[model samples]
Target: MGTPKQFLFLELFMQLLRIAFGKNMVCYWDMKSSIGYRYSKFTSNHLIQGSANCSHLVYASAHFDAITFEIHFPQHDPPLPIFKPKTLKQSHPKLKVYLSLGGDDDANDKYDQLKYLHLMEGSEHAQQKFIIRTIKFLKLHQFDGLDLAFPLPRNQPSQQSNIGAFLNDVNRMWGSPTTT
Candidate 1:
């Protein structure tokens, strides 16, 4: 949701974009997951300064049915903007904008090895909090779905039940919006 304060300004700004670029306007995902972008640095660009923080956010948004903004667990506290209703309203209403999880492999690389894994392997309290916060963040951000991009921890005997419970709770609460 967007504040009423953003309505007039957002509409006007979007309209200016439409006029400037016409129907052929170059679309893009301006907001980004900082950690995901950093980790994806390629060998070709290793010596060069990367153009900007967010890539893979195609500018031509209208051509796609969806756009996903992958969020490292730490990216969204409540949620981030540019994904809010006012911005999405410019796109096809049916467009699916998802907030994906688990870009922390590199994020946690410097510190705790299983930072993302903690959400899966930690105490029930931490795990549940992660799940609940994720749900709340998505709703607040007007995200259409959740993407789980991490592999489950290896060789944990209890993971079968734990994962099942996690899936059940997320599915029960989130329905089709939750994707593996």
Candidate 2:
């Protein structure tokens, strides 16, 4: 019999194989969605900057499905514009691209200043307009879907409700594509 540590390592390796190939699982990572852009470092210069190490695994893993590039609305532009789909298509043809909105910077003062007045609470028409505009923008760029990353304090009831409404409006506007 092998040493305890060796056996544990072997078991872990087997589990990883099962999860990585044996099962038809799909894993997605929210790359560059929050305060830092560190995750981008590992991807290709086009996909992300620091994503070098995981680039191989991201390509090799049959279980990995899509990459969601988070965009902090009103704070930064979409990073998808810089992404090169050729690399991803070569490795995983089914890999889909999505845009995530309302990350950390969306709550900052700069974001507040630039916030679309139409997206304010209790304005269904305004919310619809915002969603329609986002869909059109993403369609123009060939994005698959939208991932709302709205971050609000747990105790803020009003903000949470408004966010829910916003999501509903977006879903309704985009029709929520089933593929991505």
Candidate 3:
């Protein structure tokens, strides 16, 4: 049997081995967890852990290469951050933080998030506006990049092509100082 500290070291060792072999060590910190969602234990009645915080990652920052903060598409022109990431970035200067867009928490919703994504893709003006606003949002929040987490609809070739085009457009404008 290994002690808690020994197990922690073993976990770190395994993470290093995986990284050495070129495996990505990415972590997604959901907004729900960040805003205080406690996780309970399955067996017996006991609380396992509290909401996730930057301190949790700061302690074992070496194990992660990047961390993605999940957020939904903007209802307005520019998206707002659910939590401030300045402290985390300052604590671990080398860690890359990304803003993940387009995740659905409710499966029972009549229209999927993909519907809105498709709508945005259909209109060139909408796509351009979204790209511009997203870039500014990333710069304002000090995000390393954007992660589009929108899942492709089944048997929708046009939607897939549209997403590709959107990605290309974003990449093109990402290097520009002003995308107007």
Candidate 4:
């Protein structure tokens, strides 16, 4: 049997292997475990909650590149409490923590994701709202970046173009010195 440290090392090695050759290593944390980080086994019985956190695996990861906390759709508004940037930075200062923009978290979430994409595609006002809110969310939580995980099954060329435009706006806004 492998010791805990050995298992952790193996996990880290596997993640690095996946990230090799131009791929980025991004981990998904489930929506449910918002409070997992707030407790120890000594403090709460919710220790083994099914969510990923920097505490468990980040240290083992050697290169430590980047990790994104997953699934923040427009429907859910502000979702879970992600790990603080300061905490993750103290461990691996260069490691980037991003907030994932869209992914279906459940059956109902598929509907919400579709709506989210439709709003993004159809309404410039909605797009601006999303960008503003997302910027605020990132700044509030001190996330280093944002990751767009396409929310819908886009069919038309124009649909893809709309998403591209949305991302371009985000990139433009992201590079600016102003926070507001």
lDDT of 4 by residue, 49-110 (tens): 21122222211101100112122333344443335656656645555666665444423544
Better of 1 and 2 by lDDT: 2
Output the TM-score of candidate 1.
Answer: 0.45
Off by over 4 Å in 2: 1-40, 45-81, 84-87, 108-120, 176-180
- Write one digit per residue (lDDT tens) for candidate 1, span 62-179: 1100112223333355443333532543434434555545433334343343454555555666655566666666677666666665544568666545666666666775664542
Which parts of model 1 are misplaced by more than 4 Å?
Answer: 1-82, 104-106, 151-161, 175-180
lDDT by residue (tens digit), candidate 2, 93-149:
555556555544444454342353225464675565555566665666555665555
The positional error of residue 105 in candidate 2, measured at the CA in angstroms, is 2.3
Mind sharing the TM-score for model 2?
Answer: 0.53
Query: Which of the predicted structures, 3 or 4, would earn the higher lDDT when compared with the native?
Result: 4
Better of 3 and 4 by TM-score: 3
All candidates' TM-scores?
Answer: 0.45, 0.53, 0.60, 0.58
**lDDT, candidate 4, at 167:** 74
lDDT of 3 by residue, 58-158 (tens): 11111101112222333323332344445555545555667775555322344543554554466777666667766766677666777765545668676
lDDT of 4: 0.49
